[model samples]
Target: MYALKEREMIFVFTGPHGAGRKTVAEMSGSTLGMKQVISYTTRPPKATEVDGQDYHFISPAQFVAAQADNEFIEVSTVNEHLYGIKSADIELMFQQSGSIYLILNRFGAQTLKKLYGEHVVQIFIYADRATLEERMRESGDSEELIAKYLSHYEDEMAYRDQCDHVFENVDLAHTVFDLTKTLDQNLNRNLLDLD
Candidate 1:
């Protein structure tokens, strides 16, 4: 556990579908000891995904009920499914670890950056359209679903310049190494500034 006196850092990984944002976030978060903030989703879990780990899978009714109660700090709809980050979950994660990682869309990342100001670090990861399409196909996404996601590719990529850091995820190992190194340098700089 981190000391209460230490400043909290919120790392937001934003990218279009099939950009490997979640994978990179998981690798870098694990390497840097940052807690992963699992989000709630109405979408069904993938075969390789675990409940409560990859996402808090819930029904549409449950999602609507939680939204009615203002439980989420950020929410977005993707491919006809709702996804959200519960405000309570963020608080709990902060208590457990000073630094945290979140896999969110561009809009959600913007919301968090607005809320946390400088504490929020936005990282954009991207791949070429052909690579993204190939990745989605390999991940078992339907052709129709891939088309829907790809339709917004340009819009999503527009936010890349807004991020604090941007990475091209050509090689997973190299991308993870670079992400971890960047975070380490930021952490060190923040520590000195805070002191």
Candidate 2:
């Protein structure tokens, strides 16, 4: 296993679909001086989403070629669609000063944790079933899909123990403040603090 140097920190944000991962990522990136790492997806862009900004929308053939070339740091299938984070994008971000944050799903987070180990600061965002359902409803998700998501909520919650931080995103402003404080305290401590 490769041990992490004190200077390196990789922040990972993960949660269920309606739990506000992307929103938190955007807000946190703006506040933390960290760039939001855009991921590639085979799924078509949503009506409100812009190409490259929301995701690097690509054809399945292109995705497969990238995978074959070992270009992705992590990849996974979600709701019958494929998503991946390019390895070069992460490496390039780390090449700059300050920390890098990647917003990903549980499977991708687990894969990155295995690859990066101590260099990573994994965070799991969560909310109660009612809160999640309400958020999903507001997003216009179908009841059947919301029910399916709720059915898997318990299993998802169980994975929280695997993360370095488990944040309850009940209040967006408060949660962002709390997360910023935690990152500053844990990852921005003095050099000797790692000892």
Candidate 3:
């Protein structure tokens, strides 16, 4: 694919688990016609997930082989599963489209920010603890997993202050609408800068 002539934005969506970060990222990709940065995960796919769409599901052995070969820009273990973003994949995405969005944890967000500087826009989405728990349960997460996520709530929340934008995700439609507006303004500004 040909690269976009003008740089637009790389949106990194992150928040505590169950905060609707992935949902917002997915919505933005579909609603705004943005390219998605899909990561590789060792975790088994959920009933609603599709390989290469939500994530590239691989075996633990495959994950380790890729890691040993330095295939990832950032890697993290969550719930005993390996997750990583390949450096080549991200570079290719940037080359193909100026507008790209990804769902990431705080560590991945920080790594991308360090690598890309001003080109990366970090957005933190969060909701109340009760709402988080409800959402997790509704999504069919195990009770143990939900408990574990809640245990690290404070740690995850602390990263919000470091983000470029933070928004409560209690209302999905409103949040997405606001996010799209933010992206549009940023895109317009960046396009103008190219001239």
Q: Which 10 successive residues of model 2 have the least lDDT summed?
A: 186-195
Please, what are the lDDT tens digits per residue for candidate 3 over residues 118-178? 8789999999899999998998988988998898789889999999999999899989878
TM-score of each: 0.92, 0.87, 0.89
On lDDT, the stronger of 2 and 3 is: 3
C-alpha RMSD values across all candidates: 4.4, 4.3, 4.3
Which residue ranges in model 2 land beyond 4 Å of their true spot? Answer: 1-6, 189-195
Q: What tens digits encode model 2's per-residue C-alpha lDDT throughout 25-142? A: 6786676677767889998876668998889999999999999998886899877789999878876776673578888878888998888877788888988888999998888777
Ten-residue region with minimum lDDT total, candidate 1: 186-195
Error of 3 at 21 (Å): 1.2
RMSD of 2: 4.3
Q: Look at candidate 3 and tell me the lDDT of residue 2.
A: 24
**What does the lDDT read for residue 80 in candidate 1?**
88
Error of 2 at 50 (Å): 2.3
Clash total of candidate 3? 0
TM-score of 1: 0.92
Which residue pairs show backbone clashes in model 1? none
Clashing pairs in 3: none
Model 3 TM-score, all chains together: 0.89
